[model samples]
Target: MTSVAVKARVTGRVQGVAFRTWARAEAVRHGLSGWIRNEPDGSVRALLMGPAASVADMVRRMGRGPGAASVKDVLTERTDPEPGVSGFRIVG
Candidate 1:
């Protein structure tokens, strides 16, 4: 399987919601490694690296976010996976 890294920014009603928590859980479930965090601009940003298929699924889930989150947009940029990401996390 090809490993890929994605940098994503989810906008709208994402702040103060369980978006990051949901994202972390989803990433772990997909066996991906990276981190999710809330941006100062009220968006949720994430860096995900894993199998291409799994990363795709994670991105889809991030587009929807948690039930309480109103995700208006999800912008993702595909890139090369980095080395040494132990597990999925919620970063500052």
Candidate 2:
């Protein structure tokens, strides 16, 4: 399958809202590999890598986030995939 990687930056009510945990679960459920983290700028950033379709789906899901998150924007960009990444997780 064609694998791809994408970095997504989520803004608006993303911090301190369990967004990282929710993102991790979504990535795992999609069998993706990468990481999600809280940025100091009050945004959530996530790198998603997997089958092209799965990555796209993950990005879409991030737009909604958890119920506590009032996602205002989801900015995404294609990036080089990390070959050593395993399961998804919350990272610093």
Candidate 3:
């Protein structure tokens, strides 16, 4: 399994809908390590790190966040994984 990292920016109705919390839970469930945070521009940004397949799955799931969220778009890009980061969390 190839480990990979992905950076994603999720837009539209993502903030104030428990998106970060939900993402943390999802990442943990998938054994991913990274962080999710709310951007000042009202978008949610996340770094997903794990096996390529798991990260891909997480990205797909992020496209449709919690029921309260109305995700308009999910933009993703491959990136270097964070060093020494373990477990998922909500960060500023």
Candidate 4:
């Protein structure tokens, strides 16, 4: 199976809404490896690398994040996979 690495920027009521935690859990559930963090601009950013189907599923979930997060938009793009990410995590 082919895999892909993607960078996603989630906007709107995302920050301070447990978005990171939700994202991490979701990513792990989908067997993805990546890091999720809050951006200084009040958006949530994530780098996901895993099976193409899983990554795409994760992106879709991000759009409806945690219920508490009113996701307005999501920006996704391809990227080179990073090394050494054991699982999904919320980065500071």
RMSD of each: 0.9, 0.8, 0.5, 0.7
| Top TM-score hit | 3
Collision count for each candidate, in order: 0, 0, 0, 0
Residue range with the least summed lDDT across 10 consecutive positions in model 2: 83-92
**Model 2 misplacement above 4 A:** none
**TM-score rank order:** 3, 4, 2, 1
lDDT per residue as tens, model 2, 1-92: 99999999999999988899989998999999999988899998899999999999999999999999999999999999987889998997
Global CA lDDT computed for model 2: 0.93
Candidate 2 clashing pairs, residues 3+ apart or interchain: none
| Pairs with backbone N, CA or C atoms under 3 Å apart (clashes), candidate 4 | none
lDDT of 4 by residue, 1-92 (tens): 89999999999999888999889888888999989999999998999999999999999999999978899999999999998877888896
Model 3 residue 18 lDDT?
Answer: 91
Query: Worst 10-residue stretch by lDDT in candidate 4?
Result: 83-92
Which order, best to worst by lDDT?
3, 2, 4, 1
- Pick the winner on TM-score between candidates 1 and 4: 4
